[model samples]
Target: MKEKLARNINIYRKEKGLTQEELAQILGVSFQAVSKWENAQTMPDIALLPQLSRTLEVSIDKLLGYASQDRPITIYEEAYLTQDYYWGTEPNQACYQVLQRMPPTKPIKLLDIGCGEGKDAVFFARNGYEVTAFDVSDAGIEKTKRLADQIGVHVNVFKADILDYRLDQQFDVIFSSGVLHYIKPEFRQEIFDNYKQFTNPNGIHFLNVFVNKPFIAPPPEKEPNAYKWHSGELLAHYQDWFIQESSEIVFDCNSSGIPHKHAMTSLIAQKMTSLDH
Candidate 1:
């Protein structure tokens, strides 16, 4: 079913002419995220439905990938997600520094794709941006919402699949961290085509994705194939957009003690003013 969803997302996004990296940026994720979605190895959480619908210019009902009258979110999962998503640390300094460099604008509207338990969203919201956060899980949304309420701040939360989401309005900035490596390729392109439309002409986009590398864990002696990886050179395809900064680094994820399994490449690109493309 997840694979079917990935295929459909790719078809619609390409009919529109978007690149995987482009889609990941708009969806506030990494190119790998779009790849994953296309491959059907996993699914986006449910709360991102609204944003996904708006971004993709599709209906929420269609985005959910469900035809039956069933709530996209499950109760048990919601309980678990809400608790787990928020149990992590605060926003990283590198992320904060990048966001602070943006030009000032009134009523700054921001979107956080794959916003987990609202950690990143809450950070931006508290710092004076109007934030809209979405995830694929209902539990995640509930947890984010509850946390926001406790903190006396407001963050619009929803369940959505970014690939199929549609939006008429644009944003001032879009942010996603450690999120895009999951998206499948076809859908990533769709997102790129739409991202420019979703942001103000000069809007800034911050993205983080994995750099291609070999696996670290001891091979099972008969381990399956490792995933293919990509780099900034591939991003050159979208040269029209000013590639502000693209770099590779290694960082610890959670307390795993293992050198990060995925080497990361981060991109900070500012949208080109002209839409003559």
Candidate 2:
């Protein structure tokens, strides 16, 4: 396992165009320490794995040399297959409200992460935003493509896992709804880092993450899915950004036709523009 991790670290670092010295600088360690790890002479402390993987833009599972194909995909695939509109057909009210507030003359480039069935992507496309949407589930991407076609709107939809997804271009608005919590606790920060890096200056991020609350039921032992954030934990991640709106609310979820209370942290924040500009 140590050997595999060493090789993976080397590979991912090069993939990100980072030298050993550069990686060390980012991690606040000496270049020799980075070299020792890659050489398999030593292993990074367990606590550094999250930060290390985040800096490399890879998942902890991938950094440890687990088979990429072994990552969980079926649960989401089944969810999209079993339900016509799993979350709902209508776009979230917050999404609509944000779009209405955008300047009319500026062209918005939007990226919708975990865009199931293309509801919000299509809505944005129809509203004149250049939209790119992706989901880990192939079924979800296909459904999104079909919906976009049916609506006579163009949306670049694809299947991608957020943990390993590369951000080739920046976006004017990056929206993620009820998706961040689906990632394991360790990887959520890495995903957020990617979002911040790929968003254009002054761009807005609209996100909602599940949070633990007294009223919410405990996670099922058998399923073992979705990480719950502690109160105010999610907000702390966006402290440097210009917060436009934030709220924690408990609501009844009827998506599965089984009503259950859910706690979520919803936020809308804008990236800061360069002071020099």
What TM-score would every model get versus the actual structure? 0.65, 0.73
Off by over 4 Å in 2: 1-74, 219-223
Candidate 1 worst ten-residue window by lDDT: 218-227
Model 2 weakest lDDT span, ten residues long: 218-227
| Tens digit per residue, CA lDDT, model 1, 1-277 | 5654676666656656788888778878788978888787766667655666667766655644633124443223434443455346387554575466673346778888878777778877777788987776666777788778877889987876564454457887878775565455545665666765788877877877666665543322221212234777436535777877778876555333343344677777888777556
Compute the lDDT of residue 245 as modeled in candidate 1.
77
Model 2 per-residue lDDT tens digits across residues 1-277 = 7777786787689778899999999999999999999999999999999999889987888788643454555366667775476665688777786676564357899999889778898888888899998887777888888778888999998776665565668998988887776676666676678789988888888888878877668543224455567878777878889999889888877655566777888888889976864
Q: What total of clashing residue pairs does each candidate reach? A: 51, 0
Cα lDDT over the full model 2: 0.79
So what's the TM-score on candidate 2?
Answer: 0.73
Q: Rate the local accuracy (lDDT) of all candidates.
A: 0.65, 0.79
